[model samples]
Target: MRLVVARCEVTYTGRLSAYLPEAVRLLVFKADGSVLVHADSGGYKPLNWMTPPTVIEDGDGVIVVRKRAGRSEDRLEIRIGELLAEVEHELGEDSGLEKDGVERHLQEALAEQPDALEDGLRLVRREWPTEIGPVDLMCRDADDGWVAVEIKRVATIEAVEQLSRYLEVLRRDPTLEACRGVLAAASVKPQARTLCEARGLGCAEVDLGLLRGAREPELTLFEA
Candidate 1:
């Protein structure tokens, strides 16, 4: 069996919801500015824009499609109501199409989501551990103390509580060399931050702005 990996970056200009009542369009260009295929609106339109077949240059503001067969194509087309469908799908049948009190980001996109926690761990690699449970992240610093991180989008009290539990478990582990626990998130509650300090656990606050475009989060160590 052969597995094909699609390498494409999504640069969203408008809304990323499937519930939005508008059509979404994408422009695909070949390496030489040639148009190969335009698939959108449940149909495929071939060569409607490009006059000649050419190589599309890298970073040309167009979606470039490459296949293992050495064939490539590009298109300028709309995804029709795919975005709206996706949004609706995220809500599911039980949660109707109400947008007033619904979450803007998908549940999987939230910090509590496993993927988000893993992503945060990638940013804090120096502290990664070989074996750990389903916690977001586990790492060791120069001091050889364990740093267990839990990421949250909204940085609520519950997130801190969850991290606190993970820390408690780590503290009891005889194999874990470090005795300190760290809780990190996009934001942190005052009480949660206070509790961490009172409990002698390390605390780190991550800025979403820094995580967006910055290379990584800067760590400043202080004696706890």
Candidate 2:
């Protein structure tokens, strides 16, 4: 990861036009050739970002970031006003993401009892393969419609985005045109819930203890 902080003006030109006036902001250059420009606020989402398969050219005092989509091209140019700081770190190879406790345990329990996520939901298979990656679970609803399940420890916007991608691919198949998506997690952030609802996806909060074979009455007794 390379972090650069500088006072710069950014201009984006492509399908749309955007401009970030001169200011002190953070620029992140990832090992994947992705670049992100971030303001001090706006939570975690960057002000502007260019995904991988991009090229970055750093001149004396200016930087040009460009990406090509299909036959069209998009470009982001950053004109440096002042150089603040720059640092790079050689983070070793990632061993791969480790699922959280809730994610692992909930997925296992849900696989054993698909109805735990939705009534009449029957498991077709776990880790259903796709070009991108394997879905957590693929199932059939009461109507036999395909349901793509993505289990997360804590549902966030990224989780919803991932499920959306899976649904896009699955729905492309004529046999699964009626396929839908469900995001099951221990808890869901408001933003995530809103995005899922807007995308016509279903959201369910799984009961960790119940899925683990704990009696509900015992939970109530413990709560009391």
Which has the greatest TM-score?
Answer: 2
lDDT string for model 1 (76-106, tens) is: 2222222222111122234323322112222
Task: Note each model's CA RMSD in angstroms.
Answer: 20.1, 5.5
What's the true lDDT of residue 59 in model 2?
98
- Each candidate structure's TM-score, on Cα atoms with residue i matched to residue i, is 0.36, 0.68
In lDDT terms, which candidate is top?
2
Candidate 1, backbone clash total = 19
| lDDT string, candidate 2, 1-224, tens digits | 99999999999998899999999999999887779999999898899988656889999889999987556888999999998999999987765567877789899999999998889999999999875568999999999989999999999999998898687667667898789999999999999999999999999988888787686634334554
| Candidate 1, superposed: residue stretches over 4 Å from native | 1-133, 214-224
**Residue 140 of model 2: what lDDT?**
96
